[model samples]
Target: MTMRTRARTMTALLALAAMTGLAGCAPGPIVEDGPGEAGTLEVQKVNPADFAGQSLSYVYFTDGPDEAATRELIASFEEEYDVTVNLEVLPYSDLVTSVQARLSGGNAPDVVRLTGLTDFRADLLDLRTYLGEDYAEEFVDGPVKGVLGEYGEMLAVPSDLTLNGPFINVDLFNEAGVPLPDSEDPWTWDEMIDAATKVQEATDTEYAFAIDKSGHRVSTVLSQYGTALVGDDGAVLDEAKAVEALQPLVDMMADGRMPRDFWLGSGSRYEGANDIFLAQQTPVYLSGNWQVGQFADNADFTWAAAPNPCADECGGFPGGKYMGALAEGPNPALGAFFVQYMNTTKAQQKFIVAGGFLPTRVDLTERGVQYPVRQEDMDVFFADLARTPDLGYEANSQPSYTGASLELVDELALVVAGEKDTTTAVSDLKAKSEQLVEELQP
Candidate 1:
């Protein structure tokens, strides 16, 4: 399709057209407008003729609607710039390690779509120099901080931002004659369970609650309790708050409000309770926004996204996929330019719609990308993302966090299995995390 034709098609796909903002990454504080407002941010333009005939290699992993959107964007880039972007797709499990190995071996691809930014920091191309300082400033500070190097270089442009939140079976709540909590007035952990219990019992559901078996998902509870695996000092978890977080999970499992088999059923390998939620066996599922597309596509029953329950505060863990160029890539100019190209206002709008993702750019966050489906669910997720505490980003940004988080899952599994008490688990986790942070220090 011609560029004009394609742009028109994308516009037709959304109920609203995102307003074009001031060009060249205008410097200013983001005006806090609701997502309903039109976005007013534009990407700093790149000269299509600058890298004409240049060839670049991009290593990527394909999943969800993003893969198609990426390929479409790339096709446009190749046509406009006369650049040949050789795309190589890999399995998500191996993408990071494979790219790291290539970087370590001094044979990195020109660009890569990465989830593990801190792991590839040394080899990541700093786009700030190429894309301009104002361009980097347009992104949300929290997600940007997660991908930046210690020297504050922009390692990647964050995309497809993901946040953890709660999903409920609306039918179950109605059947139980219980009212759902207002989004403005969120429920505490106990209050949420109390409501879920009533719903479960009234509807004859097997469980009141089910959370995905992920350290990342459980961290939402930690965040709600005002604690994180990584604190101001590296590898420090607040023991009292950490115990407070685990106690609820422990109590629910003991009382059968939550299914013990699901938590204990999956050993150390990551698992999710989405299936149970889909089967309508549970009244509530504490998962993330990534499930929205799947649920919208296949769910036979009515469901809705709800405000996350609170403890010390209400929030979810912040994380997202990122696009970056390699410092060692053969075509640094073209690679960096392509990275900048992906974050353009038009590109971001197309990406989120295709992938059912939340936008990472501040302008898009304010302007809002209207999904062709599930607009309300996306709104709840956007609000939950706003509630994410600074520590959520900080914890994920730590290089050691990946290893520490894996160990965290194992430790928490022990706590649920009665192999270790919360106090002991917290202590062991702190010690192990410290070791990991030291080992991963650059």
Candidate 2:
């Protein structure tokens, strides 16, 4: 058969698997004896046999650490089911826009792996029926929030959770004679800043601390302060706390505790301070779990995931990748089944270990992942993830949060650059958030 003919046949076979509306020939004689007269034809009920030679398309972001493991999982699924899945890889920046465009144009792929769900929620297939209630309840609270729809339907399953926390140069701390705090008794933000400042001064480093120029990472600091830039009601819950959360960052930039150029120079685009930390020029780096694998391989000095520092609370922001099926796809049923397969305990455990990812599954979170490298550092991040405040989840779950939060980052950057005061910047953020909420509301 020609490749084009084979493609058409595979598409029809997969569509017939779950759709009761499609009636046609397959490999041959898929129909069975049913309750109908001799001259009449009754459509056979859907069954697994319908998927025998079917095909599916899945979109995957290329930024993940365990691309090979993910492909292995897909290959296993295809081998077991005698089917095929076309994996379309895109960079993280292009994944959302491309998928959303396809969705709007009614050309979405069968399955997709994504981070933000707000824009795609309308197009996502509800997997509650296939995944079941008991299975859906197995996810940890914060990670699960990222996959739920407006009405609490499970539109996607979260995978490879990330948490924003600090990593410290253990060698620098030891060099400065500053003792790192024990895991059992973690220090507050103030104490952490003091230790970092001392280490920077003693070691003659350029900066004591550095954080990603991202609203998402900054939310970690905001959550510790018992607030977020935008609340569930599309406003700041504690305006005073929002100001307090941001003021320290502005001050840090001015005092050389942080690199002013990193924040001010990046404009509104997301930027990281990983190079400075990896070069041993900074005592502390405020990043996330995703960096562990990279740092483990590249950092010259001994580094470790530090205990999350507290202000009013002790935690970091929660975010993750999500696997979902597009409702408009040719084979949503097959797509959903694949999503379930990926979320199975065996698959999740392997993916976690291979990628050094924090877990979204409750059991995995409790049992832990024994990464081949830097297991202890991974433990610190997992510990902080368990303690993440609800505010972090609520703030990000808002449909307007992504766009508004980007604006918040740019506004705060103006404050860091001394172009705007904290009070005015925060007020502008609240106004911008409210405006976005109105514009984005369905």
Candidate 3:
């Protein structure tokens, strides 16, 4: 059947399930029915024939290359299990709205992909109940720890890992006669600005660097300065540390080294720094490993990933996408099976090789990612991930800090637009973040 027809069919099925109260069915204890032992990753214990007529739905938002790889995997799964998967693909911008709308209507998909699983923990099924606790050991600690729900529930299975850093145009540095920073002895934040200024002076580029319009990217700078959004007690943003972290960005904008339009302009947040970098209007782009495939295909000039600059310490965001089954979905058993299937060693290897993502599995790391091109650039990102401090991981992983991290992005935009000075912005942000954390408390 055509994809559109399958989607329509699934929609009708979901409506039926909701009306019949099947969508709210609580899954019974998992009973292994196949030849292989239960809860073992080595064999498939769930019989395909048992779910032969079952139809499932999934929602995902991913980049071009990852999307293609997912489609291939879904096709293989459908053929093997004789089940139909109604995959609804959306842009990153629309993913949250679409999922929430479906959920409120009592028709959430059986499975969904998300970057921040903790945000939806209440609606997600605890995979540990079905997959067994031992299965969690297959993945790396950072990715696994980031997805844990309150009360220590395993809410999701990580699909791939990513590290945030900078991508520089090698050609721009060569043309400007600026020596590249040594990866072993990376440039400090001040040194990064100096190098960028030299390149802008020697070339026609409008800006020296383009930071991704994200609070998460800005948090990397905060981490380097030893300031976190949350401390042991609650939301914490030291005034001095906040200014020290934000001052350089404000200065760069005033001096035309960084564009104000990119952050405070009419453009949407999804319009990333890649545009300026690809246009050769900026010598450096601060983003993450997710851009590897896009840059390999589109960038016309010589470029490579670099270790993020440091103040007191080197840091980068340790993040990745995860797959989870919804608690209110029609079939939790099938949903859990599909989530685990996607993370199998063979499946993960194929995804990393095809999509150029860092592996989340411990064994796959030793095997190494086999990028079709630019393996050295991938190595830089891998090294950055290795050296990332514990605070960097905690900033992204902790549930209490999620709201605060998002708020920082807006406050940073205000500082860039000259609406608020760094001191006032940080002070305002601390108050707002504390309120958010209090509301989340039990």
Clashes of 1: 1
Candidate 2 lDDT tens digits, 304-347: 99888999989789877889888789987778778877887889
Residues forming the 10-long window of minimal summed lDDT in candidate 2: 31-40
- C-alpha-based local distance difference test score of model 3: 0.77
Ranking by TM-score: 1, 2, 3
* Candidate 1 lDDT tens digits, 1-442: 5555544543442212122223424333222121122333322344446576789998988666788999999998998767799999999999988887887788889999877676677677767545554556788888887776654456788876888999999989998999987777788888998999899889899899999888888888989999888744787788889889988888888888888877786676789899999999998999988899999988999999999998888878877888998878898768887887788888988988888888888899988779989899888888777777899888887888778888888898888889999899988988888898888855
lDDT of each: 0.80, 0.78, 0.77
Better of 2 and 3 by lDDT: 2
- Deviation in angstroms for 334 in model 1? 0.5
After superposition, the stretches of candidate 2 with alpha carbons farther than 4 Å from their true spots are 1-49
Angstrom error at residue 89, model 1: 1.4
For all candidates, the clash counts are: 1, 0, 0
Every candidate's CA RMSD = 7.9, 8.7, 8.5
